[model samples]
Target: MKLLILGGTEFVGRAVVEAALGRGWEVTVFHRGRHAPPAGVRSLHGDRTTGPEGLAALATGSWDAVVDTWSGAPSAVRDAARLLADRVGRYAYVSSRSVYSWPPAAGLAEDGPLVEGSPDAGDVPYAESKMGGELAATAAFGAERTLHVRAGLIIGPYENIGRLPWWLGRVARGGTVLAPGPRSLPLQYVDARDLAEWTLDAVAAGLSGPYNLVSPPGHTTMGELLDACVRVTGADVELRWAEPEAVLAAGLEPWSELPVWLPPGEMYDAMHTADVSRAVAAGLRCRPVEETVADTWAWLESIGGVAPRRPDRPEVGLSPEREADFLAKYDPAGGDR
Candidate 1:
């Protein structure tokens, strides 16, 4: 099978490319050519943001499946779908859980109400635009010919985005690490390789429509997540529960620049937990979190994926009283304590 991937150089895309190649599928990638293509993979380069040049490059050939890990903007995806609708047998768009509405209630299903037109959604147009892209792709190729993979917090090897790595690095240092307060927070992440492998399998099975690709059952909560990280890194780090605001004031950023922090908010709440029965039923088998954590750390060590050092400024340790006060104000429920 000839599989063409859009945006095949970065974390998730690279994983998909690797998975596809491992399955002995003929894979071709289309990107801006800024980064080097994976060794021995066919590549065509052009900008997707500007015009039809990139679409033109892809117009020349046909494939059994086109997995688009990039192109979240509605217009770009719409155009690409129009261009390749007749050529490709299946179109898979990698979307995010962000497409769901905030404060997702328990057991949010694949057919749950999605976020409508919101300007703020365009801030990270990729996630926001994906909602529209899903509609457009489904409309163009029919629901049976398109697959929308709404992935959760993707964590695994070669994750340079500093989401999981920040926590891992801080914990490995064996220092007082700041963490979110409790709320029985549901945390779910899919290993990139697993996601990639599932995408390939879905294509092969001619699977279509939307599916939430997330961690399996009993794979929720922040404490378990931290424990897994500790086991992987062999770090005995002490965690200091602090207010989200205090952490921000201390120069920490949210995993993603979303509006909410505590559980049951926007981003976290939507993915605090998601039912993955459909994906599993479709042959999606994720690696154990322990294995994921260990593999991620091993990859980071090999690539020196340490957080860059900030300029040494005057130490600004929070006083015990002040820290306690901040924790009280923010973590009033005291779940993370």
Candidate 2:
């Protein structure tokens, strides 16, 4: 199989490139040359955001499938899809669950109502950009020939977002850590490698249309995740699990501040609770949380214990002083300290 991946140097894109190579498939990566892609594939240098001149290098390649992970303006996706539409047999766009309308109801599936977007749109919000990318891909490749991978919280090796990396770093610090609660709060996420593998398999099987790509609901609980972190790092850290109300009252946000944690409410339901039955039936499998945590920690350690974060994303995790202050006033056992 011949595959072309745009932005194949980091995160989900990197995972797909590696996965393709692992399957002994011919892979070609079209990236900006910012960071080196994996060693084996053919690499083409270009900046997709810079318009046609930047994409001149990609003018002549043909592949069985093309996977694009662009999260910026829809125009970039539109441009690439149109250029490759004639030569590439299928198009796969790595979209997000965020494309669903705000406050998506629990168990929302691939058919859920989506945010408004356009194929020719310029720079816009994340959700709009993703929806527009979907529109753009479909507009160029047709719905039957385009695959929309609507992914949820993606974490694993090569994670540039710093969610798991932040937790691992904080736990590795060996002190009292502010663990979000309720500890039993469930999480839903997909390992990038797993998503990549499923994507390739789906493409091979000639499947198209949007698939809510993530593990089943409650794939792992907050307690399980943090406990795995504590175990993996072997750091003498105490996970002081705090209540949802107290954590929010402390002015700490859910996803950005704590990372991968949402209080038990509508927001949590929207983010973590989704119906991925279509994907599961299509052969999606997730690794155990322990494996995901352990592998991510090992990857972080390999890269000098610091995760590369995307410039477009805001910083995640709690500040040391802020966590300390919150710990000082709140008692994990029950009441105020």
Candidate 3:
């Protein structure tokens, strides 16, 4: 199979390229030279933000599939899809559940309403841009030829987003780690490799439509996830469970600074609780959480930490000072640890 992947050198895109290579598919990656393409894949350099001339290199070749991981402007996505409509058999756009309206309720189905409208390539909002990408793909390739892989928080190796890495790093640090509670808080995420393999298989099988690509709900809890982190990293640590309200009261932000954590009774509680039965039935198998944790920890150790890679400023994950202050005060009501 001849596959074309846009932005195939980072996180989720990298996983897809690797998975496709393992399957012995002919993969060509079209991306800006910000990063090198994987060793074996053919690389074409171009900026998606540029107009016709930017995409001119891709105009000549045909591909069996195109997997787009674009998170910016709908116009760019529309132009690309329009260009590739006749050149590719399938267009798989990696969209996020954020494309759905916020405060998603429990048991939200894939058929639920999606965000609408186009966005400027510059000054693009993440959610609206994704929604625009979906529309662009469908509009150009038509429903029969497009697949929208709507994913939730993607985890596993090479994840630079700092969600899983932050957890793994914090847990590996040992001693009085403040964990978000209740400990049973359900979390859902899919390994990037799993999503890639499933997406490829679906394309090959002529499967089309939106699939909520996340691990099945209740597959693991926050506590179980942390335990896996500790086991994989061999941390001689004790996790001090902090109630969500308490953590919030202590001035800790949910999801951003905490990474992969959400407070109870918050509207975002439903973000991680999305229904993913369709993807599972369609052969989306997830590896063990421990495996994901272990491999990710190994990658972190090899890189020597996130700071070097993100030198300008590490965006996600809490600061040591902030964590120390929160840990120093044990009681949610403001007592000492």
Estimated TM-score per prediction? 0.81, 0.99, 0.94
lDDT of each: 0.72, 0.94, 0.85
For 213-258, candidate 1 gives per-residue lDDT tens digits of 9876566567666677788888777665554545565444355421
TM-score winner, 1 or 2: 2
For candidate 1, report its TM-score. Answer: 0.81
Model 2, span 59-120: residue lDDT tens: 99799999999999999999999999999999999999999998899999988899999989
Angstrom error of the Cα, residue 269, model 1: value is 3.5
Q: Which tens-of-lDDT digit does each residue in 100-216 have in candidate 3? A: 876667678797777665733453677888888888899999999999999988888888677888888888888878888888988888999999999999999888889999988
Q: TM-score for model 2?
A: 0.99
The candidate 1 region of ten consecutive residues with least summed lDDT is 308-317
Residue pairs whose backbone atoms clash in candidate 1: 182-335, 182-336
TM-score sort, best first: 2, 3, 1
Best by TM-score: 2
Residue-level error in angstroms, candidate 2, position 136? 0.4
- Deviation in angstroms for 222 in model 3? 0.6
Q: Quote the lDDT for 233 in model 1.
A: 84
Stretches of candidate 2 off by over 4 Å are none
